[model samples]
Target: MNEMGKTDTVVQPQSSLLELKKMFFLYLPVCIGGYIVFRVLIVLPLWFSSSTEQLSVLRIIFIILGVGALAVVVLGAVRAPRWVEKPIHVHYRHWAPAFFATLVILGSIGGHLVASAKINSNLALEKVKAHFEKETAEYKMGRNAQ
Candidate 1:
């Protein structure tokens, strides 16, 4: 009731539960697509490199980009509008999902880095060995023909 003895009518914005659910649904596919692209295009190529110097350069780049993306997400969450902010009472619980999502993203990026570095290092070593063997064989043949 109002101070003037009139009923106070408060208008609240309608909750968009359906919209929220749709947004989450849309996010899943985008995340999956990003994961696939990163794995196939970026990670795989870096992993298969024949030069350790090149792989190291790539590793640094990937690490920087991954960290930058995480920072952006954290900053965006912190600066979210007041209307989207959860009550202090439920803040921890509300943040759990975001925390888990960030962990997954970071973990995947780390995994890609580790896997690519290992594969690239191995590939580079093998290439060096092959080149040495080829050069040795050619030297022996030249000596025999002289």
Candidate 2:
């Protein structure tokens, strides 16, 4: 105020809080809905299958982490509108974008892990079948020679 020689009005913190709260309230439903849909339509079915046990524990861990990432994405969507309302000097606000980005990256990695695990398992099965066929053919040829 002294620099400008003008009166400086104090901003009410409650106004900021209220705006954030309203944004969260509005965003929460959409986030929750998406979370529920993803769990039901995607994660649950994949995890529930008995065949999933053939996957490595690390793959399962990645899937769990992906679920957590999805949760964070929902949370970020909820908070994003409020952050856009006014610029604040809080560290959390500064970190929000990074946090959201990490969530997306983690989720993508997890998804890739799950898919690769499945593909590797299928390839292994095919290799085993080929080896068995080759051994059978060799045994049959030896018997014919005898």
Instruction: Please report the candidate that would top lDDT against the real structure.
Output: 1
Worst 10 residues of 2 by lDDT: 37-46
Measured over all alpha carbons after superposition, the RMSD of each candidate to the real structure, in angstroms, is 7.0, 9.1
Candidate 1: tens digits of C-alpha lDDT, residues 49-117: 556566666566666666766775687588554645543323333444445446445655765567576
For candidate 2, write residues 5-32 as lDDT tens digits: 9888987665667657765655555455
Taking all chains together, the TM-score of candidate 1 against the true structure is: 0.47
For candidate 2, give the lDDT: 0.57
Top candidate when judged by TM-score against the true structure = 1
Query: Which ranges in model 2 have alpha carbons more than 4 Å from their true place?
Result: 1-17, 30-102
